[model samples]
Target chain A: MTAVAQPEPARRRTASPLARAWAFVRRNAISVFGVLALVYLLLPIVVVIVFSFNDPAGRYNYTWEGFTTEHWTNPFGPPGLGDAMEASLKVAGLATLAATILGTLAALALVRYHFRGRGATNLLIFIPLAAPEIVLGASLLTLFLNWGVSTGFWTIVIAHIMFCISFVVVTVRARLVGFDRHLEEAAMDLGANEYVTFWKVTLPLIAPGILAGALLAFSLSIDDFVITNFNSGTTVTFPLYVWGSARLGVPPEVNVIGTMIFGVAIAIMLANVLFQWRRTPKGAQ
Target chain B: MTFFHRHRWLTPYVLLAPALAWLVLFFVVPLFWLSITSLQEGTVQVGYTFTWAWENYSNAIREYHTQFFRALLYAGIATVVALLISYPLAYWIAFRGGRWKNVLLLCIIAPFFVTYLIRTLAWQNILSDNGFVLDVLKTIGLVADDGRLLATSTAVVAGITYNFLPFMALPLYVSLEQIDRSLIEAAEDLYASSAKAFLRVTLPLSMPGVIAGTLLTFIPAAGDFINAQLLGTPNQYMIGNVIQSKFLVITDYGQAAALSVLVMAVILVLIAVYTRLLGTERLAG
Candidate 1:
């Protein structure tokens, strides 16, 4: 099928100067642009990392002087950004876990069901996707206040779960659509019940997509600023802390945090790519 | 699968139950309350009560409408910019790049794997007073001796475009990749030039992605507060900032809720029209 589709274009590749130019552009454009775009994306991040060693006064007119770990080692520094960092990690960790579990469950339900109001249910899931973060944060805040719930970790977790579940549902549901039902049927035929069939058969197949979705959720929850800021009360996630610090000009310590997070994300994405490569058929390669 | 077959009516509902319940309780119910609150006029001192005030919407319509349209306008422009930047890159990755495609794709998404706030704030340092870009510009005589790029509306737009470019690119890549190569070859075989072939065949097929990417970028961009707050001054405030202020700082639930509903309704209508035009009967699905 691919042979038939690509034949004439493949043939023309050798003939037309225009085709050769197009091919050359297509071949080199991404690598050229990829490097440029990557630099564009990473330059700011690199500046942050480089300037973290600079003094607080150096923040505005930053320069790479001799290195100092003063900011890093400042346990009792002004504003205690370290405390804010710790608080951010804790909030993000809790939010990640809570969102993952709820989102995964919601994904399972959406995939397995064909019930009434399914259309409405689908719409509801996506509504949050398009929801203004400020509006969501505010609405959640009001709901919490009305219920007398305090603005803290629990509220942040709840809000994160609210927004993050849509991602899991969307991701896992797409995987589920392509997944064959016969595997579960075959498992059932071998005396597995519904729960067993789901646990042993379905879960294994959908686990990757679920993990990917959860990772996306984790990143989103941790990265969230608008919603977290609105509902956080005294709680300060990394983003909120960064926002506050930006007021007095962003602290160099925030750069250290950004660098650490970026490093971890890069490492994980690299692993994901390697894993996907390994998963593809060797014969196909 | 057999159990579902035997109990067909029960299956979908059961699958949909948890998500539906959560959506109704959290999303739909809160929206109902928001709508109700919008129609009422009362400060927190008086406690919110329905005066059936049509004036709040009218007042907001007259006063905040400019900001609302400005936000929409900015988002639209940003979305288009992102699309323009992303489409060629996406096309290169999808059709031209070979085995390096996945690696390049990984790189494109790598930035997003980190927290949004960090990435946005990173730009602060890069575009700050005599920062890297500023230093380069100054060296090139683009800015005066004491000029800065950090707080400008252009920086906000650039920041938004930089961040959302991936969202626009990925969907387009997916749609473009899904398109059969034969159609393009056929267009060429029929005596169409490379450019004409792309215009006739490639563009239409990728429209779905373009629509999805546009909606994805525009919706969030319109509602984004963090960008405006962090990157721009008071004059650059978007409707999302207003919503945040109304709901959080002021506790003006009626106006906040009203604005939320209005934005939500507008987005939904746009999405509906978009899907209809695209002939995607089950858009989210």
Candidate 2:
């Protein structure tokens, strides 16, 4: 607590009024600037949420028409939006599942063992992340085109898992690196085999990281545009649908879905944070 | 040794195999194919062939240098602006948010839950020709009565900065939050002015996050096509837009592949420099 507390008294004894005002501005500048920046960052979100209720007179919901709750009650806006949203969910769900499982396994291997070619494997996992989305998309498209595999829903899922596994591995590896190995050793001493010790102890401890990684994977897959845009031959995910509609003046239903996603994500994250906060005592680690 | 120790040497490899195989098939193989495609002579109708054509690389650069430069310039400026905008916000949350730090961080991230296309589209509406932002600028004499805000470089840059601000903010927050406040206090205690203390201690210590944030912001921002497509005119189109049109519209696979490889190579080189500057362990940690 004293980290910031003890410094307050040092600035109070300034002599002149000008100096005092200067000091005040200096002290408060970062805080004011920060809040304003946050507002700028969130302005679009406020617009999106508020606009969800708009009863636009036209196809596009660009201008604010008088407020109405019509859009929120209608899950599908225009013609194909509901289907697109469903497709997005399906792809994200499958990709997240496959990526999480693969990534968790890889993270376990990386953290728990010293092996030949481990360094190469680490680089391989990292390369997808470091590569730009546009480049990755185009390359993948080229591969698919050359390989005679038509691009669509399955290609989107494959690409999502490809990019997402890196993030999952990175997240889970961080958790694993911080793990208390002694607990596992203690379990072994208590006559538990490796599998029993893992299921009973390690998995439970790292479960939060796994969940976090899965959530991250889902958000990324669902929100993806560039990569999905490339490989989606006639397949329309939510973002792709939005992009296509933007040319024709987007429907208010887009904003409705946007708001719903925002609300759900925030709720899940808050609940997770609360759960973790309750689980850990201060400085227990 | 436990039961698993009977084949301990194989355990890690077995665990890693599935994910590794997935990466190899979807990620590594695609990139290899991209490399081959880059040197091929191609027309989608006629079917492409490997012809050792290197002009695809040179011609893309010569043809689209304007877009390439614009992409670099836009991404570079956006990275700087995002850093400047996010640093104080992140600093405030880290040092002063205290009991509200997690909540503050969540607020910072909340906007991103909205679909990316929607978020960009929201900006498009807000800065529409007759919308709030332009009206304000017009009223304040920042823009002419007939001058438009949308379809300009400023709008494009601002959109990029706003979209990537969270990427910049979160890493900066993590680095700033991890700083030992006692170190800052010690500098103050030694009679160094607050500004001097911050410059010599706080800024340098947070370089890893700053570097990481810049890379995160720049790479994606450079590769971004939606912002320019939605908010700006043909004049504002970036390299990403060009590459997209090449692959999908123009159907110039070889040129697109070469351009993708070039961009990836450039990004890889930048990352190598950054990694060297950060030192490998700092990046790993």
Candidate 3:
């Protein structure tokens, strides 16, 4: 302990007052600016949420005309948001499942083994991550046309999966790097088969990473507009619907949908924070 | 070599199979198909025959020179702006936020969870002629009585920057947080000024973040179609907008594919140079 304590006084003496002030400012700035930035980030979302309850003529300036549940209750009215919401959820859910499975499998393979062309394979996987989404979307469209496959839900799902898989692989790979391989090896040594060892030991260890990746995938799929717009013929996700509607002046109900989605995301993120906090070492927290 | 003893040969390939298969099927094959489509001369209707035309590339460059170049310019500017704005926030969050770090981090990420389209559309409400932002600006006499923020290239660029700021911040934060505190303290103890220490030590250590964040923000912003479509008219349309119009409205697959291939090539080159310069190990972290 004495060996580490020797340089402390010298370090303090040499530090300048300006440097000390800068350090103080640097440290506290996140909390200060974080509050401002947080407010900036959430302002639009909060405004949208609040305006969702306004009367139908809440266009330029939103005045609270008492309260109206008309948007949520009568979702199938003139501006039927229900259909779009349902479609978005269905597409996002399916895409999430497909991407998660594919991504997890790919991650496991890359992390656990070294193969010929591993470098090339790594590049290929990350290519999707780095590729401009517009290029990817256009390429997929062209490929589909050349193969004579009409654009539909399947095409959208496939496109979503293509992008989402990379995220899954990237997230899971990070977890796998710090992972101890000994547990699986020990399981195999104790008469467990390869599959059993993986199932019993490896799967549980990587489950949190998988969940994080899956949540990310789900959000990406839900929030996608460009690729989904390209592939869906007459189909519309919530974003697409919102975009189309904004051309004719945005209805207040769209704000309601936005608010609901924002609320759900906040809930999920808060839960994630709590879950992580519980899992963290007490000292670290 | 004993075949039975060399189970390593099988293990690596087995582990890598799924990822390799996915990359080949979705990414590589699709890219090759797009390339082939680009080389063809005709539209999709007359059954695009192989023509091996190099004219498409030159034509794309000739016809959309301004839009293409403008897209790149906007992307570059937005990326730089986001980086400039995000660095201090990311730096504070990473090195100095203390116990509120994770909570603040969540706040940074929370905006991303909302549907991107909705967020941008909300900006419309804020920036509309009689909207809050415009009203505030007018009150301070920043514009004429009719000055508007929407339907302009600046709005599209600003929107892109606003949405993508987190991508820049997170990667930068990750890189900055990974920096050793001892290095900074060591410089201080050696009687180096804070500004000197930051320039010599902090900036160099954070190069990986700058590279990754720039790539992450710039690539997407370059090809962003929705921002132009929603916020700006034909004059502000980007390369991505052109690609979409070609494939969907114009039904010009050859031109679309050619455009896509050009972007893919450009991005790939960027990635190669970036990875080479920054080294993937650092950026990947």
Candidate 4:
């Protein structure tokens, strides 16, 4: 500790004010840049939220006219916006559930057990992650066409699940890698059956990870445009609706939906953080 | 229960079966099916037959080479921009955020929960000819009287960087957060300046995150069409736009499949080389 401490005073003593100022600038540059970067990230979302209440005279909401609550009062004023939102929600829900289950199981198998095809399985899972969305979407379209199956709701769900599963596996597996396996062994040693031990001991510990993965899958599915575009045929997800409307003129209700989704997501995330903080012992932190 | 306990080797396989089957049927088979479809010859209306048409690959490369190159160039620029914008924010969140670290990280990610199309469309408003950004730029003499921000390659790249910034930031934050402060202290103790210490000690340690972040940003950006479609004119369209138009607008499945396969192959080879150059061991973290 002394050796570590010695350099600071000595450097301070030798350094001039200009040098000290330079050092301070160097030290704080990242933090400053970080704040600016955060602002850049939030800029578009802010536009969306602010524009949600803007009552444009024309169909295009690109320019703000004046503030009004008309859009919020009739949030589904757009022709197909409500249906598209419903389709997106349904797809996101089903895809998240399926991806979470499959991913958690794969993660368990990969982390808890060693087998012959383990490396192959890992590679297989990663292929989807590394592949571009365009390729995945196009290829899936081709597959459906060749198989004599048309693209629609089921096809969108399948496509969402396919890409989403890989993400779920990656996120859940990261969590599992840090987990302590001895708890499971201890549970079993206490005369609990394997099923009971897994259910009681392992499942609860990894539940947060699973939930996080599911949230990620849900968001990815809901926001997805490329894959859904290819496999959606006549089906219109929220993103598809937005794309179609952009050519004509985007409605203010689209901004309303965007703001609502953002609000709900932020609320849930804050709640999670608050819950975690409350649960953790002060000393542990 | 007895039979399950006795045949424990089958447990992993049984657990993995559902996901493995799902991936094999949807993911792996589609990749093979894509490759086969790429080799077929015909239009969507006429129907395709497999004659091992290798020319499709060459034709895709030959015909749309400009779009392919543009896609790579745009994605490359966007990745670099994202890295530049994300690294400092990630570093600050990792090291300087203190008790608010989780919240800061959440802020970086919060904007993503909104629909992607809406976010991109928001860019349309922000960069409009009479928008505040352009007005400011025009007043500052950074932009000419008639110069516009929209319908340009720069707008497309900016949108790509904004949309994918979180992917770069999160991985970087993960790796940077794991770095021990003691190691940095030790470097200072050894008489290294802060900048030198960061370059020698901190930078090298974060290479894995850098590679991961870059790949995460670059891969998706390369295939992204929404930014180009929404922000830029046809001149700025990427390979994704071309593939999307082929599959949906023109209904040329054969060419679309070929282009998709080519893109996938190129990305795979690039990733392989990247992993080899960076050393795959670092990625295990």
The candidate that achieves the highest lDDT relative to the unseen native structure = 2
Among all windows of 10 consecutive residues in model 1 chain A, the one with the lowest summed lDDT is A1-10
Q: Rank the candidates by DockQ, best first.
A: 2, 4, 3, 1
Give the TM-scores of the predictions, in the order they appear.
0.89, 0.95, 0.91, 0.95
For candidate 3, the per-residue lDDT at B17 reads 70
Q: DockQ for all models, in order?
A: 0.48, 0.69, 0.54, 0.65
Estimate, for each residue in A1-285, the C-alpha lDDT of model 4 and write its tens digit. 223333466556766788779878976887778788888889999999999988888877878789998889989877888899999999999999999999999999999899889999998898888888888888888789889898899999999999999889988998999999899889999999888998999999999899999998999999999999989989999999999999998988899989998998999899998888788766453
Which model is ahead, 2 or 3, in terms of lDDT? 2
Which has the higher lDDT value, candidate number 1 or candidate number 2? 2
True contacts kept of each: 0.43, 0.77, 0.62, 0.74
lDDT of 2 by residue, A1-285 (tens): 445665555545533577567657976987888789878878999999888988888777778779899888775957999899999999999999999999999999999999999989999998888778998899899889989999999999999999999999999999888999999999999999878998999999999889989999999999999999999999999999998988988888898898999999999989976876778677442
Kindly report which residue pairs in candidate 3 clash with one another.
none
lDDT of candidate 2 at residue B174, scale 0 to 100: 93
Give the per-residue lDDT digits (tens) of candidate 3, residues A71-134.
7775445455778888888988998897888888888878877677779878888878888888
The per-residue C-alpha lDDT of model 1 at residue A181 equals 93
In Å, residue A10's CA in model 3 sits off its true spot by 3.6
Span of ten consecutive residues with least summed lDDT in model 2 chain B: B276-285
